[model samples]
Target: MFKRLYCNNYRGLVNFEIELDELTLLLGRNGSGKTSVLDVMFALCRLLDGSAKVTDSSIFPERTLTRWQGRKEQTFELDVELDVEFDGSVQCVPFTYRLEVEHEEGGRKARINREILAANGQPLFRSDRGTVQLYRDDHSDGPMFLADWSASALARVQPGPDNRMLTRFADFMGRVIVCSLSPASFATEAAEESERLGRDATNFAAWYRHVLQENPGQVAELTSELRKVIVGLDQLSLVKAGLDVRALMVSFAEEGSKPYSLRLDEISDGQRALIALYALAKLTANQDCALFLDEPENCVALAEIQPWLMEIADSCGESLPQVVMCSHHPELIDYLGHENGILLSRGNGGVTRTSKLKDVSADGVLKLSELFACGWEQ
Candidate 1:
């Protein structure tokens, strides 16, 4: 899991460090930049995987400067500590990936100023736009030139004796999953199996079907878990649509009545949202990845949200991907407990600030949620 994130001059983030746990919940009012925190991580993943196009015209970073403070040339530094199987043994290591970007020629272009990767506080590789250097076990491989300033040299470089850190970092970054739940995709007709769960779960039906096929008995387990919260939900099955079309269908029944079935759209939006999240949690239960959910309480019923989150929390074990969720729901804040809650609030200057609930002193009289409701400040 990610240990800490230090972001400087990135959008609403102005030199802030967020301490993370296995399951961190981002809490703030609307427009407080809670989602921006998650987006920064997503942007880094894209950059490490060679998918980010850093420029004045790009969708990400909308602007290089922090709007309120008028700061420019963002620097993102991240620390991730995880255990990996290395040399036939399990070893825990701390890895840091730092990236710095600057605008050139009066905002006409954006370029990378520096990129550095380190392990256990030792520099493994460091590069500037002009020259790239590789260090292995504390030895430098001299300076190597880069052809393109826009592309990431670390992402494009292949794994060799000297640069296994780059390979490991790239592999981890490639698998980080950031998603905001989608009900439309859940209700759509199946096309084919998905490569991975899309950002908005646009391929949910296909991915669900793929998981059912690849891991037999997994669907049955998911159905059993869903039945606990959604009392009437008996099972989730696939049905043939018009002609050769296929879609996911859910079946429900009263205590002594015949069962009825509904397609994704036929059900309430809240139901579809819960079902999609349930399937994703079950599908990724045993994988190594990072899952980020943005405002998961959007369509979910208030009463059911607690149980739904509890179920997801139960499914995520130590070896599985860690989950980070952004939510403003008071019940969600209560469910996360005081230790896991990170408060994000915009101050007078429109700059966002982050604080842990434990760090804030309370009277020991009010519940965590109550404290959050009353402005979190004494």
Candidate 2:
């Protein structure tokens, strides 16, 4: 799981650093850079995946850079620490990835000036204008030149027995899940099935079907939990729709009554949102990774908020996935108390600042909800 992150000169953030817990909650007003933080993280994922293009798409090579507005030679950097299991043991690996880009003529394109990767404060690789070098095994092998420049050198390097640390980092990055779900999308049929839940939850029913096929007993557990909060949500099933269509349909029945079934769209938006989130939690319950959620409380009802929070917490287990959720919900803050709440604010000349509620609440007397409700920013 990701333990800490430091981002510099990225979008609305100038310099940001925060330590993440098992279930870290980003709480503050909107536009304080909460979504920007997650977007940057997602951009980093795309960068490492070698999927970003040069100045063509939303992720990279110039779209993700902080708008310089004609400022000279701005750079974007991130220092991330992850505790990952490798060779049957867990280790905390720190990676410092930086990119230097210069805007081309007319601001339509950005060219890479420099890109570097350092692990545990030791330089492992560097790329200058697309030419790359790998400092193998702590530089004992000197710098071996690699040919890739359009992608991250760290992702390009093939890890051997000597560079198992790099392999672990790659594996951890592959498992990172960033979800920003849309309930409407959940009803749509997927073009192709996914091994894991999609960020938008477009393949939710297909993924849930896969989950149930792998472990049939999980439905009983899911139904038990859903029934507790949803009153009549006794069972869930995936049924065929038309020729090749499949959908997640819920069954509702009270004691001594015939059960009724409804498709996802037939249900209220709040119910659909809750069901998708619950399915996501269950699908990722046993995985060890980082899950970044953008405003999970969207479309959820006020009465079901507490139960939904509890269900999400329980799905994360005692440790795993290191959930980082962005929300402005007071109930969520109140339920998380103080330790898990990381407050974000735009201060100090329009830079996004961060501080944990644990630090803001003196004497530990006020609940996090009350602290925010009482205008803690003032």
Candidate 3:
């Protein structure tokens, strides 16, 4: 689970730090940098996992630098707690990963200045410029080499018997899921199984196919939960659509009549969102995964929001290790704000700031959401 995050000079986030819990809620107005936090996490995960490089403009664009600040360097740090096995015993370890990227020539180009990974305040991997130093599980230096400054040297490290700790951290980062579901972009057809869901979940069918293959027994549990949110939902199956292609099909059971089926894309947006949300909770449970959800309540019915939130909340710390969600819905705010919410606000010059929801005092008559809606929480 992620323990804390520190970011400097990345868009509106300047010298920002936030402590995370098993479940955290990000609440604020549209431009409070709630989504920016999620974006940073997602981009960092991709960078560390070798899926993206430091120079990828889509992930880290020229605009990544804070506009008001003249600094050319951006820094990010993540602290994660994990139960790691070594020396024939399992122990909880604290790992810290830090990255610094510098912009050059008026911010048109960027390169990694420093990248470091430490465990229990001991360096396991450190890179400065093109020089790299790799350490072993016993905290002794193993190798020193020069790597590409634009890429992650840690990602390129192969798994070895003495580097289990480093490999474990890499695997954990790879499993982190960040998403803002757009039901309209979801495809009904899947060309092949996907290892992970896309950021927008456009390849949901492909990812779902992979989930079903990995956890066949969980299908029944997923269907049972889907029935609660999607009325009359009987079962979900993948049918052959074409050569090496499969399509997701949803079946509904009706009273006094034969069950009817429909393609996944044929469902309403709300229904599709509900399906994705439920699958997210069930499939990823107990899998040592971290989830970041942006506005999951979108397209979901008012009555359904709390139940889904409850489901995700209950699974945290046990089945799911960490979850960070962003939302402004009353159901979410009233239910989780006081306990788990982190309020993000823009300070002078639009630099993002963080505060606890419980710290804000409000009149007894107004709920947390009401206070926020009426600008009392501001």
The superposed Cα distance between candidate 1 and the true structure at residue 38, in angstroms, equals 0.8
- Cα displacement (Å) at residue 119, model 1: 1.1
Could you tell me which 10 consecutive residues in candidate 1 have the lowest summed lDDT? 55-64
Q: Which candidate is the best by TM-score?
A: 3
Q: Output the number of the lDDT-best candidate.
A: 3
Question: Could you tell me which residue pairs clash in candidate 3?
Answer: 286-319
lDDT of 3 by residue, 1-378 (tens): 899999999889999999999999999999999999999998888888888888786567668888878788899999999899987899899999999998886756788889999999998999999799999988899999999988788989999998888999999998899999999889999999987888888899999999898877778889999987787899999999999999999999977779999999999999999999999999987778899999998899998998998999899998889999999899999989999999999988888999999899966778999998888888
- Candidate 2, superposed: residue stretches over 4 Å from native: 54-56, 61-69, 72-80, 83-90, 101-107, 111-113, 135-148, 158-162, 195-199, 206-220, 241-245, 312-319, 361-367
- Residue-level lDDT tens digits of model 2 in 181-280: 7777675443334555556666777777666776565567667767776778877876776676676788899888898988877887778788776665
Compute the lDDT for candidate 3.
0.90
**Deviation of model 1 at 377, angstroms:** 3.9
The model with the greater TM-score, 2 or 3, is 3
TM-score of predicted model 1? 0.84
Please provide, for model 1 over 1-378, each residue's C-alpha lDDT reduced to its tens digit, 9 standing for 90 to 100.
788898888766777788888888888777777777877877777667777666624324436477676545778888997665666787777899888887654566777778888888887778787367777634456446664666567777777765665577777887787777777545467866654566677677877777787666567767887897687998888787767567888899759889998887788878888887777677666657788888777788878787777776775555355888898677887788576888888776777888776777767787777876777542
Which sequence of candidate numbers ranks them by TM-score, best first? 3, 1, 2
List all candidate RMSDs to the true structure.
3.4, 3.6, 1.3
Colliding pairs, model 1? none
Residue 168 displacement (Å), model 2? 1.8
